[model samples]
Target: MLRTLTRQSPLFTSSVRGFKTSAAAFVKAGDSVPSLTLHENSPGNTVDLAEETKTGKYVIIGVPGAYSPACSASHVPGYISRGGELAAKGVDGVFVVAVNDSFVTKAWGAELTQGKDSKVPVRFIADHAGDFATKWDVLFDASKFFGNKRSKRYAAVVENGKVQNAWIEPDSTGLDVSTAEKVVGQL
Candidate 1:
């Protein structure tokens, strides 16, 4: 069969016209962390990740939700349990960030830290509006599993407000990469 020319043909496409389509760049090594105001414990308490990372080495962990199964079971707990080792390796703090409200984050943080002898400070921060996740390029649509947008599971090693290294979950919310053991050992 012979094909006829059509307006929808690939040859008659925007790409062939040389129009460029661009997507926002994801946060990676050498990228400067943005200065987005976040909250810890309460709205009154503000956490500035950029400023916190400026003085020393820090790990910023992004999660999909505050009390989800994976996040509650292993992800955040790994970082909390290994906080001492992280501190010994010169890590100043571990910030657990989620796109939940301050109340949820505060309660989760307290529960996770209860009776744990973590040496480094592990602070659970609320990215209530997902602005931080968007800036980091890790925000995703999780309306199917979650109610709204959620952050991809990720870990970024920041030094002096610049990313030294980073790991983003290939599946958006997978458990393979960005584990505390994997990231901390490298640091």
Candidate 2:
């Protein structure tokens, strides 16, 4: 049989799949945050992020877990320390959501913000069974590490119930694009 292609054949193309440095994330600007019943401080206190942000601007930061290493040491603290700066950027409030129970979230929030300048009043919330993350399509199977599903680290600027901007860590657990400094600087 005769081979149709040669080294200089125009029909020949690389076999490697196409790769893009910046892939389109599941969350994007203009996406509406789901109106789910999330717990705040306790199960009795229910909050709907969509409803809360429907009439104002807010920053929603989703972490993999409430007391995880990155979340406790750097991620949450960064936002707490720079709360004033975030407020100056027109962000009405900043909420940290984790796929943990309200009790854990409440304690973690208090510990993280104990002596910090809470200019923007970062509200730590319990995503409560990863409902928010699943609805928003930011849930990932972290079973190997977390032993359960978890939310991807993301920072979104919501205005009038719509996402004005978002930065989701492509790897789901990294502390890069979703870092407080980067998100705040852009805003």
Candidate number with greatest TM-score: 1
Off by over 4 Å in 1: 1-24
Estimate, for each residue in 1-187, the C-alpha lDDT of model 2 and write its tens digit. 1255555575665676686686445778989989999999999999999888898788899999988999888887888888788888887888899998999999999888887776887898898789999877899998898889999999999989999898888899999998889988898
The Cα local distance difference test for each model comes to 0.90, 0.87
Most accurate candidate by lDDT: 1
Off by over 4 Å in 2: 1-25
> In each prediction, how many residue pairs overlap at the backbone (N, C-alpha, C within less than 3 A)?
0, 0
Candidate 1 local lDDT, 151-187, one digit each (tens):
9999999998999999999898888789999998899
lDDT of 2: 0.87
User: RMSD of model 1, in Å?
Assistant: 4.3
Question: Positional deviation of 15 in candidate 2, in angstroms?
Answer: 29
Cand. 1 TM to true fold: 0.87
Q: What TM-score, computed on C-alpha atoms, does each candidate reach?
A: 0.87, 0.85
TM-score, cand. 2 vs. native = 0.85
- Report lDDT (Cα) of residue 126, candidate 1: 97
Tell me the deviation in Å of residue 73 in model 2: 1.1
